[model samples]
Target: MVFGTHRALDSLTLEVPPGITGLVGANGAGKTTFMSIVLGLRTPTNGSVSVLGLDPLRQGAELRANVGYGPERNVFPDDMPASDFVKHLAEVRGMPRSEARSRASDALWLVGLGEERFRALGTMSTGQRQRVKLAQAIAADPSLVLLDEPTDGLDPVQRDEMLALIRQISSEYQIDVMLSSHLLEEVERICDNVVALDAGQLVAQGPLRELVGDVEGVTVELTEIDDVPGSVESVVARLTAAGLRVTREPDANRMDVLGASADLIADAVRDAVADSSARVRRIEQRRRRLEDLFEVGAS
Candidate 1:
């Protein structure tokens, strides 16, 4: 999609399957524009979008009726109580006013805001307000939810709760979720798939396991071993002479073996440790994470 003369998102084509899918990118990679298009808030310039099997450009209203959007911005009315605001939006989506009010109560309760549903949003904590936004999104019982920076401005504890809630929204509630965030670790924790964008183009998109793939090296830990005499320096020296590239992390009591098979690295670690009089405590492959793929990685 083009924004005036600048191409904000180009040649980006993909699908969101069941479960939680993470959309991660740098600041200007068009994550928000993509969400806007899917939400029918913005029309794409060149391509068409199929959100839950509906064309967003043409069937915008029908699309919005079934799709929920938890935007990053704080757009709620401070004077209004939380439940009233959520119920009003559901009413806009064609629910009867009475039904909307009931659904809004249920939604607020689901998001742990039942007690504060009647409270004015202006007086709520950031975390509580964030949950209110989430309740508003799912108030109409959307088939799909697009969450933009769902954990933004949350403290560590609140961030964890929101992330777990997002997981529940997808797993327990059976809602297909497209989570847009720059937090790679949060994505790794909850998402089944990952869509990575760079410079307005899709750089990678696939299941998390498929996207990260496997590492080319192995890591060995000696920290748990007891009564060993040798230092990491001696172990590294022994492994180096044995024709293996080893990166010694003395502070962590571990060593990374590069350019070798897992079996080979494990055997080498055992031999090197034996020679150095220390014992190998643990051995495992050094797996790559989603953040490693981005030039300017996710936060």
Candidate 2:
């Protein structure tokens, strides 16, 4: 997508299916702009996008009818009550008044706002307001839903609750979801597929597990360190000399020995203890995290 003269998305391409797909990136990384183009809210400057086999720019209304969107920012009318606003949106989408009211109530209940359905939107907490936004998105029973930072501005508890709700929507409702988030942990928890972007360019896109394959390594934490940097450097130098890729973490106390066999890591640990007076608190193999893939992809 282009915003004036600058390209926000460059030759982006991806395929989404029936499961949850995560769009992850840093802020201003074109995540939102990509979603906008797919939803037909913004047009791409160069490449084409087809959602559910329909060109969004050519069939905007038809595509949107089957695709729901929860925007990143608050766009609700605070003056209206929560139920009223949702019911109005449903009706605008061609639902009958009675059916719209019923669907709105059901949607609110689905999003865990059953007790607060009558509350004014202005008085609702940020988390509650977020739920209302989600409710509206799913009220129309679209097959595909786009959630943009659904848990943004929420407390840890609220964020967990919202994540659980999203999981239920994907599993119980049997709906395909395209969730956009800057938080890797959140996406790791809820998404089956991931598409990562950086600086308006595509980085990686695949099943979350496949994208982060089995690349196990070892992490060594030491205590009684005199000079943290010096100890780490000495250990890394020795490991490298022994033909191992030793990465000293930004915080120098911990070092990750990569692509080394378990026995080699054990030998290196033994050498580190023998050479220095540093107390070895822990040394064990660590499974790679989704954050690791993100870091590697970003670099």
- Highest-scoring model, TM-score: 2
Question: Which regions in candidate 1 have their CA more than 4 angstroms from the true location?
Answer: 213-216, 220-263, 270-284, 295-299
Clashes of each: 1, 0
Q: For model 2, how does the per-residue alpha-carbon lDDT over 114-217 read when each residue is reduced to its tens digit?
A: 88999999999999999998998888888888999999999999999999988998999988999999998999898999988887888888888887645567
Candidate 1 on 1-299: residue-level lDDT in tens? 78779998888889877889999987898899888888887877876789888988789889899988888997678889999999999998788999999999999999999888999999899999889989988998889998999999999999999998899898888989998999898899889999998778887888998777578888787743456544566678777887889876446677778867888878888887777777668888887788777843433
> Per-candidate RMSD vs. true structure?
4.4, 2.5
Model 2 residue 175 CA deviation in Å: 0.9
Error of 1 at 6 (Å): 1.8
Q: How close is candidate 1 to the true structure, as a TM-score?
A: 0.84
Residue 52, candidate 1: alpha-carbon lDDT: 82
